[model samples]
Target chain A: MTGPLQQVLGKAAEFGGTALAKLQHTHVPGVGQASTTEPREVAAARWRAVTVFRDDLAGPFPELEALGPDLEVRMQPAPGDRGTELSARFHGTPTDEQVGELRAALRRTKQLAEVGEVLRVDPQPHGTRKATLQGAALEGAAARAPKEGVL
Target chain B: MKAAIWAGVNEVAVEEVDEPQLLNDHDVILKISKTVTCGSDLHLIGGYIPAMRAGDVLGHEFTGTVVERGKAVTKVQVGDRVVVPSFIACGHCWYCSQELYSLCDNGNPNPGITEGLWGQSPGGCFGYSHAMGGFAGSHAEYMRVPYADVGCFVVPDAVSDTRALFASDSVTTGWTGAHLGGTKPGDVVAVWGAGAVGQMAARAAILLGAEQVVVIDRLPERLAQVRQHIGAEAVDYSTTDVVAELRERTGGRGPDVCIEAVGMEAHSTGIQGAFDQVKQQLRLQTDRPSAVREAIRACRKGGSVFVLGVFAGPVDKFPLGAAMNKGLTVRGAQQHGQRYVPEILAHMESGALTTEHLATHTMPLSQAAEGYRIFKEKEDGCVRTVFEPGG
Candidate 1:
């Protein structure tokens, strides 16, 4: 293997790893196919998975069919993780308008299947819980830092 | 909506903050009827827990009426009177599946911060410092309860709100401490700190078949409560030699189990207390482990040691030597109230527990700042202050 060819192979492997890590590679071929008018690079970027939800519940698959056929949600088991794995695919590339809707829908469906629903927060639930200024000193100084069963 | 806001260190006020909204499908909107101040909240308002943002709503132990529910909430319905546990559990995480509610893996939305703080993140808690999952506390007219189907338990009409409120945290935590302490028939238990949690721990030990229970505290009022209501021998540790007295009462052997119900910020009557004061003042240690250190020192060799009190960071002189030499089995946790909620309700219904008397002060939610002042100063022998959000 020459240096140039070997470098190209290495780059390809790195790109594959990144794609798998992102879970962006389309499992369903022709599902997110580009139209004749669309640019290939733009279409690929839009088709990449922006969010993924995985869980294992001992019941029927979430009837997210209301999510529509073009917008597909798949559930399957991944090794070493509990419950099912769920991911969504948008037919063609997802527009900015479609992405937020898909993320919200996927989050809702996953919460429903896994824990029954998105655990809501009051006055806004999701935020940083850290205190304002206490950690600064210990951090500057290089500061360091449950049972089962019913009775 | 009005709620008790932690405006700054040593400053608590009832202010108008936006009432909680339903941010998830499993969420429920509760019109809080009864919310109580917890001892742990002191750590928050004292600025010891760190990362407490101004305007953080504060109150975790509460009972309420569910006024609204998200589409997915099925276990509880709108208009149901319920008591929500302090620590939020997703009910399906690895920790929740194991019935360890406080350690629920998926419950804390801000895992990155907690992971940075504690090496690994635990579950979120209401109105507790943001270091835990920073869910808003319940000292408000309306509370947003996440995973209502899992965390909210219905209160039976037979059990009054006053009696059932402790089921959310104090009662369950004491129960957990006793249960984890391996309290059983013929076992002698020693509990440090006669606060609400301490009294409950003493009672739980007795209920679990402990032959004798001894509670140590400096407050006479709390000691009396422990002696009379909890039916335990109370030690005025400030004057008496607690370690010596326990050994004498236990036939020259220390207590079979020791429960440290007083979390951080324990008052001590000895030189160690002074040391802790200096250390805490110098920012050398995050917790004053007077009760916990005493619990370890006083437990019988080979006895189980359980810390029901929560401590955030490093402590000086934890008595690791005593633990290793004596072969002590130590267990501690934030209360997994979810696991014990049903049992506690049954206990309340059966008259095995009485918490109504603990609610010594009931005030309108608007007086929250005053309520915290009385609680912090132990004014009028106040053991607990119950705030009525709808009062």
Candidate 2:
């Protein structure tokens, strides 16, 4: 464990025993009462990260080896998709924020590799693809918007 | 940049809008030279499509000089003349890999809308409607093309600007209809609507060695073009019972292939049209399938029914029973343009296809609204109205 996330969780554990002891039987607004103590498999899941890529986010699994020496980054085919899913078992459990940040980092790497940056639609060119709905366009209208252009 | 914005139903305006910047690696910006008004555009302008936003830039069929290209673009270079099809296809999707470019998975950025309606989304289109992936339109001084390598095709020097322009949408769409319909040697093909698409479909079938091609339309000029330019038979559906005439002409076997290039806003003669108009007015059926209706009934048993028309909503009385029981093969589609642009361009260069006569009027971009008005009203026998952005 390293950085502020490590320190925050460490300090909480030192003061309240285990991290789960700090927030036992927590109440979530919409989800109702949440069990602070989860099953062993669910607890083990916190340290793992799964990211789905629509376009090819995966190139080489270079980052997976950095988690630990014995950590085997299991590469598997994502269900019902052609994308590759990579998972790594960390040596130490990571905080929820750390897992989210890790997922975002993976996504950012994908954006850099595939699109050169996160793809943006703004500064939308005068003529590009449109993504809106109206009229009979919804029911059965084929792509016959109009000939506002000149040949 | 000044652009023709879809301000309201049947309304257009030349408004000063932001110059589109190259936003992606494979993007290209075109200094638009020419654009043409198409028959389908009338659906949006007349408010039949009803998806146009107040400030949406309208216009899609265009040919322009490439002014800039994104980092990943390699096929097209700056200063080259290029024509892009209206439909947007990302070359890497499973759908595109299968050569069904129109049904590209990544084409429509907002897939939920189309998914709810069609159960699956089609590829995006430029300057089409928001329902089409509302890319700003090509009616401006500059237009941006995403997946530039996939959609942009270079226009040969031999193909004149006017000739190359229709290749973007109208010609390609017509070509798609004919090509996908499997037009074969000695086939007797019947096409509905003698407009741009119909003309091209007839010509394509002729080129594909069809023995006879019959084009049906109400307009005299469009039918005249079918006879004179296309060298195909014309059926004045307004004067004759289209199904009966087609059957009689085809020696009771009907045409071997019936192509429906006329789209959602179809009209019929007499009582059927009256019934459709009433049903349409009451919001019961969004599509008037007279052209499609007649086409199915007119096609021979075991013949192929190719539908190149655009039907947005459901129709009440589709002749599915005839199609099913008669062993008629019904295939309708938006243009899978990426699959056909190469051959179509080759045809254009080889002089087998000449589309220059289709552009009946040309106006400066500043007067784009007037061009659309002429198109909407069909004044001056305007089959197509071209606009010059630099003018």
Candidate 3:
């Protein structure tokens, strides 16, 4: 690939990764899953949570505690005995990177509690990675998937 | 090890790839015995699902012998002949606890891709796409299976590999549609697409005590298989109007349950068909929902419609008004195989559910490109091409 082509493909891959994360926060009429029209501040202010399937969720939650003292973590019994609702939010305005970190931390905490190990997908069997723009974009999206989502 | 992979759009090839290892304590490695093509795989191959990249491994419905085991995997053992479900699920999740394994929270490691598209991610599926999970598929000689105790079921001693193989996906998926669509005694059931999933769906309805079942398709070979092997009535939509024919067969009340096994690439006739084809090709709509539209229209008032096909995104010309007016219950999902595989295997053992006929063509993994060509083109009466990776 030429230098210009390589640069364009690299940008496309980056766009693929960030665009997915952007969609979670953007409410597109009839096109996106995000139903929220809240401002960025309000969306970030709200508690992000996962319903853990365990009734007895005690902590020493190392995942949340590692997020620093500025984060407030809480847990409550979920309705109908579904499990505990583990939630967290920043004390002050947080950057998008901080929010992404929180999301990844919460997911890892849930996985470690439920499945005993964080699930891995990389280093698995796969063929050549063609240098096409679409393939590169998808590769970027998969790379950023764990740290990006409604979580 | 040799495996089939998606090289590019409408391109498939056999390549030597690295073998999978135990990624999680609950995972196991399987030396795959039999893996077959599914209608859903065509969506990935054709690039209709945007998440698939080139060189992604491609088979999912499979049976294999457990070659290695993780330390925490207590129930399943090495050397166990098992048929693994395509959707990987953490057995103890709330959704898995509720028998909705496909909706598992812990399955998809890469949740953002699907969460962005569908609001929430379901479970991860082997070899489907990154939107589901980036797990390697079973088309290879050996593959890793996560959550083995929940997803892998030991094949019965009496059941052969071919028979037990369909139980992994086709039969279980069919049973999911029939059982969840609320098929009951004396009800008339109509299935769209006389492919393997459609045939199996009709058979499942019959086993569930439906008094009448009819399968609709354009292929004469598949229709013949429906009547001969599945023991159900067949409707050739090429010659007859499916809605009118179904109504006439059911005494004008229409079918009590309508199941669509045709996925995003459904075939139709006249202007509607041309319209869908053009829209899909132009990237206006992500899927062709001709079968779903027909099902909703043909279903009786207060009837239930279950979608057994795999649809990626939105479709144009959906029959929402008809569904609302008729009080139809429309539901669709990726198959929750863990919930239904046991009963399907039992049925297979008794010869009550015959799925070996669905594997119309069998070949070595090296002929994967040709196999997919025949299966996709529907030439040579190839309902499915079962790949023997080790051969």
Ranking by lDDT: 3, 1, 2
Task: Give the clash count for model 1.
Answer: 11
Q: How accurate is candidate 3 locally (lDDT)?
A: 0.90
The lDDT, on a scale of 0 to 1, for candidate 1 is: 0.75
For model 3 the TM-score comes to 0.98
Each candidate: RMSD: 12.4, 11.9, 1.4
Each candidate's DockQ: 0.08, 0.08, 0.79
Local accuracy of candidate 1 as per-residue lDDT tens digits, B1-391: 7878887779887777776787888889999889999899999999888656666788899999999998878889888999988888888765677788888755765443454444456788888865565678889888898888899999988999999899998999999899878899999999998889999989889888999999999999999898789999999988999999999999988999999988889899768989999999998888888888888888999998998887887788889999999999999988889998898899899998888878989999999989989999999999999999878
Best by DockQ: 3
| Residue-by-residue lDDT tens digits, candidate 2, A1-151 | 4777555544543442222222223353212134466764566454343433343555564444343464445556666664555455544555543443344344333334433544345556342222233322322222211111000
The TM-score of candidate 2 is: 0.77
User: Number of the top candidate by lDDT?
Assistant: 3
| TM-score quality measure for candidate 1 | 0.77
Q: What is the DockQ of candidate 3?
A: 0.79
Worst lDDT window (10 residues) for model 3 chain A?
Answer: A27-36
Angstrom error of the Cα, residue A23, model 3: value is: 1.9
- lDDT by residue (B1-391, candidate 3, tens digit) is 9989999989999899999998888999999999999999999998898888888899899999999999999999999999988899998878999999999999998998888887888999999999999889989999999999999999999999999999888888888999899999999999998888899999999999999999999899999999999889999999999999999999999999999999999999999999999999999888999999999999999999999899977889888999999999999888899999888888888988878889999999999999999999888999999999877
Per-candidate TM-score against the hidden true structure: 0.77, 0.77, 0.98
> Which residue pairs of candidate 3 clash?
none
